[model samples]
Target: MSKEIRNLEPTELWNNFADLNAVPRGSKKEEKVIQFMVDFGKKLNLKTVVDHVGNVIIKKPATKGMENRKTVVLQSHLDMVHQKNSDTNFNFDTEGIKMKIVDGWVKAKGTTLGADNGLGVAAIMSVLASNTIKHPAIEALFTIDEETGMTGAMGLQAGYLDGEILLNLDTEEDDEIDIGCAGGIDITAKNVYHEVHTPSNSVGFSISVKGLNGGHSGMDIHKGLGNANKIMNRLLYESQELLRISEINGGSLRNAIPRESFAIISVSSAKKDTFLKKINTTINEIKKELKTVDANLDISVTETSTPKKVMTTISQITLLNTIYAAHNGVYRMSNDMEDLVETSNNVARVIVKEEKITILCLTRSSVETSKFDLANTLKAAFELGGYQVDLSGSYPGWKPNVNSAILNVLTKTYEELFNSKADVVACHAGLECGILGTNYPDMDMISFGPTIQGAHSPDERANIKSAQKFWNYLLTILEKIPSKN
Candidate 1:
């Protein structure tokens, strides 16, 4: 048991979270966590079922007097996004996250805290383990690969669950209840590149951008933080005439805003000093432009070993222009809802290989047509650069239900506990709710969680105070669950 986390408020919840953090559960590599959950369910003597794709469901019978209430499902993902800083030496495969308390927040050491869904999973585990709290029949669903593919939710069968109400424990804000969310699709664009011998009298230099606060591309798209890939593209485009590209690489995931990017280029030795100066000037200008959102943005140039080959000018130009022209960040705001993002694109990753240059992107929108339209726009941009484009991993948005019964119960419970109404909102980020709803069309779902910041990044943290309040609010909601007429 972790003394640091076990001492926090809502001790049961935090303790469970600590235990989960002890295992390596990165997306698509969640076998150990899945086994732990299964063993946990057995220890509690609860009815546990592991679905075809590794989604776990643990069922607990209704308390003595609440047997008449409708069955409820408390859902969260088991796998977490694995992200670490460039300077951090932590490994997600063999080690548990090192957590620390800072100013009343629980954060990891230079790595993602996994609080995006880990806290939710802990809350569910606590509830299942509790014998004191009154509640209706409960089903705790732990899905897998939510960060990378959402494969667990995708493979869930229609008749697998008996719940009429689903409480998705994945939202980040404690004061807001997410009733709907945007759908998304992943795009990969690839182009062949021919490398020729390095130009005579040229030297190789590496340019890099780092220290930007990259976050969940969908949720943080409107923050105006720098995109490392886009920044690298701008610099390359500006220096195309004087440089020959040897390699370009940025970002690793298709759903995270890039925090760092690097490119290797060959430049004439005579212009080395001028080239470095120009890049430094560009860095300063960019920093000034994004100072409000990204205070530590860093761009620097350093000499590197001369490469034997560089990209053809035509290929370099096409690649840079394609990246420069591709849309990034918020593309449109919702007309129906105030302060809602309706459509957006994230140039999530870029890679240069000996044979090909590939770019990966994710586009999201609550409206179906807008999502496809944005995908078409990206396809066109890459096609014009002679790249083949493919899109997959598409999921639908969850439309809001104003007449949701569970929503009424939750709202009433929240008001009774805190004397303030919870904000009902729609999220721009993709949620498993959107995909799960399709199989269980009649279920009423609402998403909420403790106050978490910097999700999907190394700076991710959960507020200790909010975690307790969120846990109490959830217990009250479950205890007061109303019976279906």
Candidate 2:
């Protein structure tokens, strides 16, 4: 555990967070963390069990006077998005997150802080280990693989949890409560073609797009952030007449707005000057358009050694056209809810090498039909370019119930404690509540947490003051959980 973070206010929460961050818990690869949670539960002598899907559940009887209150499930995903700066040297698999306190916020050094759900997991740990904090019967649900596909939640068994209420401490903003969230599907396109040697008089140049603020593809999609893959493709499209792709690679994760892209191409030597001028002009235009949202965006071109093989002109055209056609930002706004995104897509990843190509996208929507609508649209665009597209990992959305019992409880409690009403909103990101509710539909579910910024990116951080405030609110809310009805 980091000494500085352990010394933060709300030591109970921060200390546990420090310990949790010591374990590398990336999505899909969570065996170590799963064992860690199981060990933690057993150490506390709680009724611990691991489900078939590797989800950990530790049950604790209610505090002395609160045993009559309704049972509540304190839930949070154990896995977090792993992102690092291009210049930062860090191995996520073998190393723990290194944290520092800056301007009243806890941030990791050049890597994701894992506060997205790690803080939530820590909060649960505090509550489960506490002997004095008042609360009803508790079923702590620690799930895995939430950042990528929510596979852990999807595979959770029906009878494991006996809670009547589920409090998901995964929301990023401390001032708001979330009752609903969008569902999502992964869209992947793949193809293989023959490679050809570069033309006799071709000159090689490397084009790179970097310095953009890449963030969570779902939560930050509407902010008009730059998609590095899309920007690089734009330049390629403009210089198609003189350029042939030797290799192109962009983005890393399927759920983050890409931050950088690099492509090596060969251009006819006679048209080299014209290509440079065209690319510079396009970069200026792109800068102007994204000035407000992606202020740090940069695109550069430099000469490089020639490669023996390059994609044929036909393949290059098909690749450029397909990426150009796919949508990269917000697609529709909700008519029913104010300012809520109804449909969106993130051209998350693009890669071309050895005559093989793959383009991946994530399409999201709260409405079921609209989700498929946008997904199929992308499928058609890629298919038109001779790529086979697959849409999978579809998850359900959590529809809002304005009259929810827990919503009323949270509203009343917030106003009583802080003299203000908490904003009730639905988010564009996928939350595990929707999937967990499938088996336990009667469980009233809601999500809220401390303010976190730049999630899914290296700049991710958690606010110290907000963490303290959220901690107090959580304890108060637990003590007030309605008695068994």
Candidate 3:
């Protein structure tokens, strides 16, 4: 089924991507992938080292005449976010990603294509293994767990390489050169709730919110797509007077905007009519609001077996109000860069079962102060509702250097190759350039890649044509690297 993927243009790059997706490289669970990379480097007769935190670094000598160019650090993450349609039957832990070519794009079957960083990783691997591509001494640094904590980048120490310039091939656009990106922190709120016996003559309904277009929370938050957690909360909040939740589960990852939610809720038989009316009303309003952005948005409710227990009234109300108070969309836009989202929040996951409830969120911003301002706002809201809020995995944002020599070289090279200027900009998505900069502050860094759409979600795909363009552009920039001063 995946043979077509290897047959794509730029056979070296696509072949590498196919081999990568064959391994189970989910975030933070990268032992096999790390070993896979190490073996590949050894097979090529290059010097390979696995760091204390599982990052793989491989060094290759410059090819022939390009020896005078400065040593370069080519980096991309080893792990990909694991997200699949609720109806898709696939296990990310043991099986390779199943991919198909669709109308100039390559996508996974009912799951994330892993092209976000996979394409970048493949590109770096292609460059490393090539004998004909002219380039300076190459240092391929593949860090792990970028999709979740970015701990791999955090744990990398200085002196790991002698590279003067870092080329990060993780950007999602073909025509954009990324100079800066947003920092992010994880917010987790947990609370224990008491469950009560099901009331006599109670009824149950399975509430489902699915078919929403979940994309990268940071990149697609501004598009006004419906968040399943928020939408599910709305239905529960509206029916709180008559409803009791037995079990609620929604969303998978904290970075992928939630696309589906499911809940087994109970209500007294007396209030069944009112409960249905309330949910139907909210469903209509949500459909109206998301019509432009989520035309396929689906919300439904149906009769189900009555569970033996449900959340206590007090706890039920608290969860509802807490989610309602929590912000789930763009908090602020960048005044420094046009069309740039400066700060945002994604109420990515919600769970309520037995005697426990947890809410997980990711807040991002290019500005440090503003990022916390929004995080604190959420902390206050969750705390007031009796949650123990904990913040973690904080990472810095990449600071743009518009005048760096490497940036100038890439800009001039791209214009010469494509006969047009690249869109140099900052992004809200978290990139490893910022965290890696902490250990190597003097290293010149830049990020650029092929066009990828619907990242961090099952709809993720890579543009076939844009990938070729990116490969051509990257090779030219490598050959034009100026000799060290």
Candidate 4:
């Protein structure tokens, strides 16, 4: 709206993206965006259908002579992960994302840019509105709540789509075409312990870890980025001689690597000065060690004027031990594919409540058995620590099919357009393709997108040249689809 939104090539694509950004559509809150798409379809007089869970499908007839070609589905999610800097004052529920153009890249003002799938949605909308592109009969499938959960994909009924080939537009890299993705499950550890009021002689202080480069736990898990919750717990565990733990908390989303964490503890007045000195020294050591990765890391300890309430020794020990023992990074690498992470877990969040302490862990793996094995291992650890564990919303991984016809088409199209082969990969992160495959066993799928960075974090940005390349590649693919034999 301001200054005509510069550097937005492919006017239709930019128009839809800018328009969609004006709607508040975080995970599980996609009604506004979904309705907007439906309205757009109605305005164009195209056939549209909305399911109970807000998944939308807009149908477009084939061009006059191309009606006999196989139907293709253009798929992408409607929701985005809502993440912002701690100092940002914007509200995702009511405010639209503030985007800025800089050096040919589009990014948000201290928040996630939503281009992970928003760009996919815009491309689909652009195709639907185009009158010049040649293509088969098409269906644009817009799913909801993909970031938090694959709800729309899980709820998709068999025969909901008539397309045999689906081109997913949710992947991040422009040069890589993803044919498969890892599956994921949410593992939770909950424990309830009694609390007791401590004598009011000690000083209360809060220790915090902030400014770490948190990213998509799945995509960035193998990068050795620091987990704030893990680092904070390590600090507390090493300082127990001088400090008494009161409360601990960190991480906000299950899929995001924790960037900041805080813990409240009490220290004896006699050892307060010594405690601060050692803590600061340790913080400096950590900063030095992680300087190459988390260059902006900040660790601080400050005295608080609040009274302290203590938890039972049993609860305190259980919580601290669990945090210390739980695995929070890469677990294994793929034996078949070099450098591919086979299994990993993120100890995403920790919360200390009135009567319980809860730890949320997310496990992912390209192999289904490995995923379950890791989940069981984490659950066993929680049980050993005297806690109740629960696993929820487990989804299957999409196995790579070397013989997929869609992959062949995309590969050929890319080679013809760019005069080079496009990289085909099986990603370590989850994609909606897996769930869609489960519902429609015969559906052929492939995922490709422009370059996007820091997807689940505040520093998210989309590359301009990659967007142009993606558009060119996609248009070529659509034009080259052959008639089904």
Candidate number achieving the greatest lDDT relative to the actual structure: 3
Q: Evaluate all candidate structures by whole-model CA lDDT and list the values in order.
A: 0.92, 0.93, 0.93, 0.87
Report the poorest 10 consecutive residues by lDDT, candidate 1. Answer: 275-284
Scored against the true structure, residue 85 in model 4 reaches a CA lDDT of 85
* Superposed model 3: Cα runs more than 4 Å off: none
lDDT tens string, model 3, 43-120?
999999999999999999999998899999999999999999888999999999999999999999999999989998
Measured against the true structure, the TM-scores of the candidates, in listed sequence, are: 0.99, 0.99, 0.99, 0.97
Model 4 per-residue lDDT tens digits across residues 1-485 = 32355336777777788888888999988888889999999888999999888899999998878888899999999899888888999999998888988787889999888997899999999899999988899999999988887888998888779898999998898889998888999999998888777656788898889999899988889999999998998887777677777778898889999998988888878888999888887888889989999999999898996445866666777777878888889988889777888899999999886767889989999999999999998998889998899999898888889899888989988888888898898888889998998878888899999999888999889887888888888888888776877
Query: Which 10 consecutive positions of candidate 2 have the poorest summed lDDT?
Result: 238-247
RMSD of each: 1.0, 1.0, 0.9, 1.4
Evaluated at residue 391, the lDDT of candidate 1 is: 91
- How much RMSD separates candidate 3 from the native structure? 0.9
lDDT of 2 by residue, 21-123 (tens): 9998999889999999999999999999999888999999999999899999999999999999889999999999999999899999999999999999999
Give the lDDT ranking, best first.
3, 2, 1, 4
lDDT of 3 at 424: 98
